[model samples]
Target: MPLWLPVGMVAGVAGWFWLPGEQAWEGLLLSMAALALAGFAFGRGGRAGRSVAIFALSVAIGCGLIWWKAERAGAPVLARDGIANLTARIERVEPLPARQAVRVTLLPLSCSDEGRSAGVCDAALAPQHSRLRRSAVGVIRINIPDENAVPGLAPGAVIALRARLVPPPSAAVPGAYDYSAVAWFSGIPATGKALDPVKLITPAPTGGPAEWLADARIGLTAHIMTELPPGQAGVAAALVTGDMGGVTQDDNDAFRRSGLAHLLSVSGLHLTAAVGATMFLALRLLALWPRLALRAPLLLIAAGCGAVMGIAYTLLTGAEVPTVRSLIAALVVLAGVALGREAMTLRLVAAGALVCVLFWPESVAGPSFQLSFAAILSIVALHELQWTRRTFEKREEPWLRRLLRELAALLLTGLVVEAALAPIAIFHFHRAGLYGAAANIVAIPLTTFVIMPAEALALIADCVGLGAPFWWVTGRALALLLWIAHSVGSLPGAVTFVPTMSRAAFALIAVGGLWLALWRTRARLLGLLPIAAGAAMTLATHPADIFITGDGRHLAVRGLDGRVALLRERTGDYMRDTLSEISGREGDDAIALDDLPGAVCGPDSCTATLIRDNRVWHLLATRSAYRIDRAAMEPACAAADIVASDRRLPDWCRPRWLKADPNLLAKTGGLAIRLVDPGVTSVAELQAAHPWAMVATDHDDRPLPQNDPNFARRAWAARDPWRDDRPADAGGMQR
Candidate 1:
């Protein structure tokens, strides 16, 4: 490992982490840092100037490729002062909040002299099959007059709409971003549903060569599905057309548990198989032509196969992000072969990663991109070390030894890659498969050997009507694989939730594991440092003393050590699932907003106190129906410690859980966060009154406003007041 490499990687890591946020100058700074580091590494290695120039050029080319792609995907085109209107064909139809709207790809249309956009053409029409009346002009929530509007409306119909000419999508979510505004710069036209009924605007494309090919794939997949056993049909569909519809959640869970879920999408595995199969068959046939064989390079032939198959798979998956990423990665490797640089090494793999980074910077954060590169890096390192070893170099091995070595290598690589992802998996997902390695052993082989190939074969056979027997073979193989996946996934200890992981833990799992896998000699032993760092972090986490929901539904308290967690409710009924996920406590042990009224549970007991401005009702017991929860929520001022409503109905859910509450609850989220034990104040009550005013206690209590955890930590870290006593705001600051 050269100094420049690691330094460059760290620089790359910084860029990768922050780029998603699109903090403009951060990218520039990281890139410059990487450039400097690479320079230092080159100087240390004493590399020539020409090599450095080539590296720079490669990076430029990569960035150029990505920018080109960004421009092509219907990126928005910017215009000057005036409003413009155009009539374009409906390129896509989407189901928005109220109506069936089509995204019309503008054709040559005109703008208004009044500076307002011209009206759209061919608004919604009463379908011969649809009599439903709809408006034609302004944006209205109405269904499209087509029966086939569910899966999607046709792409090439003509529709004219008069809309406010927006530039592009500047933001993703409505409030957070106007992605529409951003699309303006990218050249994407912003158009909405038409008010007038859409007429038979344009002829839909059908029966053309491209259409026929697409239809053939669809028709073949459907035909194959008819012959499979009922239970196996969905898996076969997923493997064949890349339609994951047939795959049940159970099937997905099984595949995920087995670490082979990536196979469901027609990605790297599919392309590799298609390309490899084609090359083998082509080479075998071409070998018979003695004269041309020597002149026609195998590289060219293989590259062709890779391109054709990669394109085929991409189209089949509708060019989805993961599929596209894999396609691009595969092409890089294939391109390397064509360029006579077929050697597999870390630099080449990094080059591939750089290509991805340059093209779709967004993919730098995607899980597929992360896992793909991790595996590739580990494999390349191990392979290089193997070739470089004294005894292993140019040495013959016994067949048994070769077989064992291959198996060991495969297992070791898989484990290394999986381990490398552990910290992220635990931090983001909080779940890990305990039996994943075992499940992968049976599932990966079965899927690669029996499922995908058989499904593809069945599709091919169906096209020629030699379907029944071929379909039968596919059905049997798919059934076996599906069965194996489900059975393994259902194993008792298949999945376990990892409570949490910190930064140190993540570094350990990713960098340390990679170190152990490829580091040479005793120096490799140092990798354990990261692993130990992670383990220590996990063990020392000292649970969160207080838990607050982003939605302000419920809050819980663990022990003094922040262990033995309890929530206000089992379900995040008041808000999003973030609370349930964050707490690592689920099922019946949930606490509700009102349960604690105003109390904090410590290592000892609980209390029931109230803050200001909100009404609090005490529950002598627990019951179930809070049907009016959404419409008639408890109203608490920004100063109230807790606004609670206790009912006396039977606990329909987790009856036993209601009986076992540590009994304290706090409504988290919102301005409900308060300064240290506002004696009896809830996070909300204190805010509404002095909403604009901030606390001046500490970095946290400086009190402009604070959310949970941060409020607690920062406050705790602050210098305490001279005394722990504050004048009365409510009954007791329940503790």
Candidate 2:
């Protein structure tokens, strides 16, 4: 435990700084202070402790160095506030068929061209890769360099350019994924529009190992795809090298539903299998030739193979956080064996983890790193118990019990690791597989026996065109198993959606799960805790509490209360029809103007939000009847409580509504609804209306939904309303 402690601290810190939020910052700061104190204690301790302490310090420093270099590599080059033609170097040149972009590392970025220095006090940022994240000084981006015009532009190539620094985009589409964060996670230099002259001062070499590895992978993928059918190639590639990029999204989704996605991820399973195979063969081959026993090199052979496998997997996966972590751990284990030491010391594990965190600090925040290490740590704990000593020492047990024990451990490991990531999984996906355990049960063995082995053989056989048939067979078998997994997963009541849970609940789930996994006493008893908490959480959830419902499908909610209008993103029948079903479940005929929850609307029933435009239009459906009560409706679009299509809006409403419909006007790329107090106008004013002073353009600011129970599914007519309009018809305006 003591040996593993430092690694835990490293992991914890990585977890801390990884998120870059208030909680993440707090965790990071606390963990860093704790590490410092530990270092101090170790330093004060005499002799051996001091040596260990120094080594730890070096490892820590090394980690920091790696992180700093990575950040620098992605930093942008740009001048500060003042205008200046700054000299910079082309940090990276990425080519796309249509266009290209150059990531630049600015040197001595300054506000003026008067030989001034930035001096690290400048607050202005330059362009950078990973646009959403802050530029770590000395880096930015520009338009793709002109190749023929510029002598040469490549990595390590210095060139001069003038560029403007722009902020990264922050908005996530209303109901879509956030690509900004994805790009930032991948460390993409700025998404820039500044393309200018770049005169290369030095030429870069043709290819590097990373470059060669990429080409090899491409060749392998092409070979495998040609040999396998449909989903077969993806499965084969994934088993062999952990590459699943070629897998179709639909197949990927199916794999996920079946809990088979982990099989494709380079994790403890693959590492363990490879390590076991290498060690067994090494011991056997060496033991058989007793004459060479003195110089058998068993450990060396095993270690070398392990290192190769780890490196190969990392190469195929492009050094992703989890894959890197696994590879590092594997290398650490192999190194220990080769050196005639124990497989791992607490210190060695910590050093490896620190090294990884230092170089790729951003991984400290990613789920992959956390889950990978968590799973690995759990396995280490299991091995340490020594109860399974004979299981490895001798194989006298029957195959049946061995199979059962294996099943138990596999299921247990999945439970432990899944428990660790459950909170994040829920926060990000809002989905839980009710029978995830069952799904993993079938997926793991099939992957181990048929998929990965065939994949390894196929790679070798492909060179001579002899492995295609074997790979094809493996792919089809794996696909069939995957199909079973997905089919079973989709069976009645297989997946249970819980909108989303609170962070507190997620935290509880995480803690309870870890406690259960690491518990030593009545360990089985502790398992009940996470299960119970999960059950309680499930019971506490309500769909209407999180969604604005229309009919029986999902819709959007606005305003603090119901006093605002409803706006549905018009996509397709599946989307609209499902939403209608969801709304109907709550028996909503029309949203009441006064019932726009927590909203302050205009003279009419338009909802008022503090969003960018400061206004919001009442949501009116062209298809489904407005389930909101008329009282709850806001005076949106400066018209009646009910909203009409774009062509039907009154003359005064056109300008305001047009501004909202930027998509229709082809002026904006987003949906912005305009809010108005249409129902507030007096008849006298309506009769005298010209511009109608009441007409509004864009909204002022859309307020963040801060109300309790921020999500609402369906808004049924207030019980015992003054009148119930079944049709909710507003005369000729009804669509």
TM-score of each: 0.62, 0.60
Candidate 2 Cα outliers beyond 4 Å, as residue runs: 1-177, 189-207, 279-288, 339-356, 382-395, 398-401, 408-421, 516-735
lDDT of 2 by residue, 628-677 (tens): 33333222333332232322223344222222222121111122121221
By TM-score, the best candidate is 1
Model 2 lDDT vs. the true structure? 0.47
User: On residues 7-114, what C-alpha lDDT tens digit does candidate 1 reach at each position?
Assistant: 243334433333322243245444554764676566665665434534443443444333334334332222212233334454433322112232334443333443
Provide the overall lDDT of each model, using Cα atoms, as 2-decimal numbers: 0.46, 0.47
Local lDDT at 291 for model 1: 75
